[model samples]
Target: MHPTTTNEPPQTLLDLITDVLSLLLLSTITVQSFIGRWQVLRTKLTSLQSSLSSLSESPLWSQNPLLHTLLPSLLSTLQRLLALSRQCSSTSSLPGGKLLFQSDLDIASSSLSNHLHDLDLLLRSGVLHHSNAIILSHPGPGSDKEDLVFFIHDLFTRLQVGGVEFKRKALESLLQILNTDKKSASLVVKEGNIGYLTGLLDFNDQPLIREQAVSAVSILAASNDESRKIIFEEGGLGHLLRILETGSMPLKEKAAIAIEAITGDPDNGWAISAYGGVSVLIEACRCGSQATQTHAVGAIRNVAGVEDIKMALAEEGVVPVIIHLIVSGSSAAQEKAANTIAILASSGGYFRDLIIQEKGLQRLMHLIQDLSSSDTIEHVLRAISSLSVSDSTAQVLSSSTALIIHLGEFIKHGNMTLQKISASLLANLSISDRNKRAIASCMGSLVKLMESPKPVGLQEAGALALVSLLTARWNKKELVRDEKSLMKVVQMLDPKYELIDKKFPVMLVNALLSGRSSGCRKRLLDAGACQHLQKLAEMEVSGAKKALQRLSGISLKSMFSRTWRE
Candidate 1:
């Protein structure tokens, strides 16, 4: 039976349990008229006695409100049974005859069985042992932790054994606790209450219950990977997808967020795709709320990392919706959309052409100028860099003076990651004479990066970009004039630096030698370039012997000897 709230003073659970036990002792009367019924009633009472005795032994029993609110009703029923038993024993003709009271005896017996069932469920649920452990860990007089544990377990009990109204109230309280206490939330996962929580997602008629259940589950999903794994193992994804399909806006948004977190793990990606969530997620991106669009796109972003899932996402027509988001969504949504496009575009030119067909590059260029957050810029830049790898797309990107300038700024002033990526992009963009001229202004900044002592990625990218530009005679003239930059390029060729790719600097020197200018050759000799080139030649490094051959016409030994004589 559900506990009733009343104006009357409440009895403590201990007092009520005691009254119930004593009432059971008093209920041992044998009726003269109904011999068989009396025996049956006695057998049920014995079972109730044993169950109640075991329940009272639980350390949390006295503190539990469900049992407290319930015991008084049991006492009332026992009182009626006792009075009826006394009546059957006392007078030959009673206030009510045996046949007249048959229904009443049956009612009493059925109510006792129901109460016994509720009690046995509470015991067998193992909540008592778990809650008791919580209490012992925080033993104190009315400590808040102790009280919270009691409330959490009671809510779990109600969720397990209580009626609809009881479960509803329990879910509300559970969400409230979950919102405020992170530790308690961890406790719920630890105690394996996720099944109970996810169970409520199927409450079709109860939208509020479903909302609250997903809300709690989303919290748990975001908590850690273990909680997410358990949620998927328990089949929460199907219910979440159903909510995305048919639930209210708020529920749909939450389901998307949970999906986002769940799919963050690469292993969980195929399960969502197998469940056919890809279409729902794309639909959410098209029409869901800003937050929903953000996280749904985020889920897509996570899953799109897998090779097969990447194709799956692209085939689902995610490209157009993602492009739409990049064009119109909020900053976070745009960032995620950009990242998803980047992942897809990194795979091949097929995705790049799709993005371009959707005018993704144009929209991404707009974001590069409009968005302000560094993280958002980083994601947008990453997408652009990946897309710009295609020669056709590189043509489109190089046409944007603003993008080339931004790449320069990012390489010169942005973080190391941005610098590396931007430099690589510049290397791609500088393949054309027109793009090389447009990118010539970034030459000094690239040289500055190459001068940095560590982080071979940035230095290597910088060298590649500068080397790509050095093919243009005017660009080579500018590099030769910057003697310090020229010396840095030569020093990078030393084998002791163990640079990732020595070919970029070697290529730069070869380009500088292309003109066969004596001044440039003399500068290379003064900067100790001859020794480094000779060593590289001995090692048979690509282009090293070629660079030395270019210098052969200058008579390297006599040139240095002539400079020393001067």
Candidate 2:
């Protein structure tokens, strides 16, 4: 009889048989993608070359006096694109060469987009929409900053007086300049440009013109504290909200970012919330594109830091949407969502319990372990520290070996915030025996953390984690033998410098002193901790005094005076 065959192959067997199909599909996709891009690139490059060659004769462009300011940038960008395309052609056959062609394609595409964007900005900025009278009135070029200001002001005055000629090309050009040059953005804001920028956002203004104006306003607002204060006082935040509520996706995105940046000032948070800004931001986070959602999440991050706004965000039912984005949003959006969650989770018990109830931690755990980005990890670590404040959540999170290992590894991270948060989380996990054992297994990492070079603020957290590991009792012998770790703990006892909170280090030494292996006490005495402890005793720190007396078997009454005893 023939043996019967099963319908499903074993997983390894199935995977082994897939190489032929996968390789063919990959080659087909790569070849098709490169071919399509190369054709498009060649077509665009040829057109640009033709345009540049005939620029001296082109009527709409070269023959027009008004096109003077736009020609140079367009010419330069075309030349650059032509050069890059040639480079791509040269690199197409070598090892890892497709990446170069692909990179060239991307750069050329974005450059074209930015150029087109500039053209559109000018067209929509009211420059081309109005009569030739203003076009002919254009001043050729300014000799200095003051002349530039006068040129811009003349256009603003024309707009203000509600008469005379085309949309404010002069003002439009200045805003576009400020958009690209940050230093000049500050200067424009300093020259009192807010009134005119806001005028561009007037209810009757074209959406496109208002859009670019909003962008310029946002750039200026980001320049400095004084600029933000100026924008905020000029009702700039309200105009931004109006655009966010009523404009195109591009305008909304810029407005959301501006609203978010402005709210970084502590004074504006409640005002934004009062404008129903939080509700709108939550909506954007729910349905906006990846880029929009990134900006929206950042806005939420800033607004939600205010207790009122954080609570309002929760009331709008955003947590579930945020959790969804954490699971499926683009990488940039995910990082922003992580920060928002971190802030919300720290708000209070209700937010923490809700996040746990929604399985937010599971998604956050995936982000932390999979992304391995330092910023994401730091934010997730902060979220975990906040969520773990609950004993119920602790019992669950404490079992993640991946998380514990990351925490231990982060102990030596370059970012002090991350190191301290890692230490704090490790300290929390030490409360559970399972986690305590996990931490004890990573004993060397903990010791290394204690020896961090920037020891300031590190000890407040590092000391607690040290105490947890050393207090495991089963692990004390190995921990005490680590002379670097032992000496670090000893060094923390010096009241001469406020290295860490005296309480944590004192508890650590007391824990170590109890049930000492003669080796442990000798480790302390040999590390010069006895002298540091004497200094603590004379300063009337009881924990240090008792630990010192136990170590040296000496009376303190005669050695230290009453004034020093407290």
Candidate 3:
């Protein structure tokens, strides 16, 4: 009888492999005694044994589903080969016998070759690596601190070597872990998993994979300085730039957020520009989803701190992009866009002029009108203030009647910060002779702002704005007409008030006194400026004695006019 064939099914992948290898060895030994057709069995059995032996080294091979499926086919094919070899060894090759057996031998040989091909494919596909990793590193269910360490390491291995499905599952788990535990971000970075995470950004065929990858990166970027630096050093920016350039709206949004956090360091700005990301960022601001536009503008704002990149942003037409965002984007987008405008404008007059050219002032006014958030309004106000600092820009702002009215309202109703920036911007606009009357309407609000005991910057800015407004002949009369405002201005000069800058208040007195109107002089006397001016003169404060002299002359002139009228 032929050696007894074992019909028992394999209990494990190792058992299947062992059975297949044993059958191949028997087939090869039996074929060695056969004639010409037997060589086919010998050659194919050797190839099959070599492929199976390669997998035998992994202790977890039985856990791999692929090997389990393919190994059984190898066993059946080997049995066929041994049977055909036995036929060839025992029966002489008569013409009819050769014809009958040749077909069976050919079929067995082809089956062995096909099975070998499948095994080769499995080996090359990295399924072995993925399977072994999964078997060893699969995490326990509990998410306590100790278990998370296991989970993190496990997920990282999956990310590094698993197939698309495994990577997706791993990324989902990683996102949850990262979102709830801030410390895990550093752990990921410390383990050098950022490279694998960023590598997923290139998986265009797998959008969910890329989406989760970029989301994880954003968390890591925002986690700590060390993570941010490592991400940059690990080529994360290039991947982010690619996403900004061509990724879907959601991907772009996540990439922008990551870039925003990374660029917060200021030192990372040049790399973004070097990668040609500035223009792509502008495109996002112009056309991305509302959330994407918001974060993209924030990234641009952070990157604009670098001088070269700041110039590049201006050259790439970020001004109009910002203007568009301010006009049409969501409130969050407008806030970041407005803040970006402020940063770019502050760099130099060229950028400030570019903002003006793009009709940025009008767009900002629209945003400010619709905005209710104090923080957003503060960002817009900072932009307005930066633009208004330039003489040319101030003249443009002076022409916006709505804006002038808004400034008055901000000063009257906004919080301390709004009051400060508003007064500062209004002061900037008032420097132009044509803007004084238009801005002078805010005198009462300015005086009220000046009345606050703290934040001397607001007080100084208000005083300065008022001083500029006093230069206008009509404004002098207006200030005199508002007795409360006049009294606040006069009180600011008192030595006991201890104002940081008494010069502007002294100039206010001199301007009112120098005017031809005796009404202002009479009003100053009524507001009790004479006593404060006298005290300042004794202290020898700059311009205080000259202001006192002017006020005394006005007093004499008024007295003579009273005598003449009598």
Candidate 4:
């Protein structure tokens, strides 16, 4: 048994050597495969590093147009490389996923910021197209939250540059963001971007940008007194005046509105005037564009409300300019011109006659005839109301048959506001004897209108006209034949309807207290108007009480004056 075992053992040595050789061969193959994979990965990493280095060195990477084209592609490549690296490192148990993701994020963020910096440079250099830049800079729909915030912050920072194109894009972006998300606007302003907007008025180009900027400025100006102070401190007034002087019609229009916002408070009026804003605005009135002229005229009117500005504007020949604008300008221009004249006429007592001498009365009469717009008619009526109060205007109204007919036609219109204004103008005209005669000639038609179910306003107007007519010396003869029309006015004093009840009694009291003539007083008393007035004095409240007091004062004055004259 021992000899047989020795022989089997001896046969095994060669077989053992062959098995060890086979094992060594397999291990070598495995090592070679791993080395080849490592080389491939190292080559890839080197290639990526070179690409990154090249990207960092290129100035174009920061340009908005170039970067806009490059960023997405770069981000995609980085993401893909990161995923591949993560997969490759997974089998090795390396911390590659988090590291790769963070590196990619950091790289992408830095690149984006750098690209935005280039856009900012372009904006500063005044080379970029505003609208295109805005489109390029805005965050895409699926942009990461952090990236969006960074993009917005960077865009806001660049807005301070003085380029018109840049400002347009920035403003467009701001407005768009504001429209979509107010929170973003709040954030933008919170970061002191408002100062940049205020600075934009200094730029020489881009009126549209300035127009848009003014809207934002108005919003910020309304926030508080402190913000308003900032607006002024930032030279907002001077810039606005410059725009008024040099900018286009649209720019001037917007600038005027902005100036109004800044000067709206009574406290700021003197400051605004002191800054030469009034003179600048007056000059803007001479612009060729109707809109610009209208806005400028409106601004001047507002400034005229301040006493010093009014004197300054009058000294500057603003009245004549306004008259010219009205006489020859378009309908809108004329409307604004009339408003300016009205403001001047009210402020400068001597200016009304001047306006009439300038044919302002004739021009306004023409507008009243030709205007179909309710708003234009209303403006013209108001101007007429102001003008008609003057003696010079009374002469014009008395002679113009067309004016009287147009006013009567307007009274029949369905708009209550127009009817009220027409009535007011007629009341002012009735101050003159000739005006009273002209109005009395229309009494038959007016009485019918008063009875119409149009509105309480027309009734009030008709009643006022009747009072004027009955009170006028020459006019009373015309009404004497229409005893029923006179009696109808007395019947209106009964106070049945709310409006009729409230106003009719006061009018009766007024007529009895101070009739247009002595015979007018006698006729009203004979109609039992005194009894109606006495009843009203007892029942009136608040405004009605005030009206009764006025009636009493008029009656007392009339009695004393009559006694003195006797």
Leading candidate by lDDT: 1
Error of 3 at 518 (Å): 4.8
lDDT per residue (tens digit) for residues 1-566 in model 1: 12323322434443544565465456555467686887888888888778877876777664444554456666667766776777777657866666778889789878877788777867876555543321223223445765665566566777766666677777777777767666666667765467768888988787677777889888888878888889988888888888887788999888888889888888889887788888989999999999999999999999887887788888889999998998889988988988888888887878988988988888888878877777778888888888877777778787777887788778767887788888888777745666576667778788777766567677778878887777777787777788778877787888786744667678778878886466677778788887888778768788887887676564656645654696
Whole-model alpha-carbon lDDT for candidate 3: 0.73
TM-score of each: 0.75, 0.66, 0.67, 0.54
- Residue 367 in candidate 1, Cα distance off native in Å: 3.0
Q: Write candidate 2's Cα lDDT for 1-566 as tens digits.
A: 11112232323222322332233223333343456765665555444434333443333332332343344444444545444444444535633576875776678667665555444443333333333334424334344676545445445433443222234454466565665455566556665447656767764546555655777777776678877888888888878877777777888787777777888888887887778777788888888767778877877777778877788888898899888887788887887888888988988999998899899988887777687567877788788889988887787777787787777667755377787888878777745555565556556555555555475756557767877767666667667777666776776777765635556667777777777556677777888888887777667775877787667766666444653465
> Which is the better candidate, 3 or 4, if ranked by lDDT?
3
Q: Any residue pairs clashing in model 4, and if so which?
A: none
Worst 10 residues of 2 by lDDT: 1-10
Candidate 1 local Cα displacement, residue 525, angstroms: 2.4
Query: What local lDDT does model 3 show for residue 63?
Result: 59
List, residue by residue over 270-297, the lDDT tens digit for candidate 4: 7656777766776777654766676677
Which candidate ranks first by TM-score, i.e. highest? 1
Report the candidate with higher lDDT, 1 versus 3. Answer: 1
Candidate 2 off by > 4 Å:
1-143, 161-165, 190-193, 202-205, 431-457, 491-506, 525-540, 545-566
Which sequence of candidate numbers ranks them by lDDT, best first?
A: 1, 3, 2, 4
lDDT for residue 206 in candidate 3, whole number 0-100: 80
Q: What TM-score would candidate 2 get against the native?
A: 0.66
Residue-level lDDT for 413 in candidate 2? 52
lDDT of 3 by residue, 1-566 (tens): 12322343334544655565566566555553335555555666677667667766545555554444456566666666656655555545534565666777778778777777766655544445444433333344455655555566556655654467667777888888777667777777775467767787787888788888888898898789998998898889889989988887778888888888888887788898888899988888888888888888888878877888887887888888887877778877877877788787778788877888888776777777778888888988888788777777677777777777787778778888898887787766744556567666678887776767677687788777777677888888998998777877887887788744677688778877775868888888878888898777667788887777677674645644664696
Clashes of each: 0, 0, 0, 0
Position 555, candidate 3: lDDT: 61
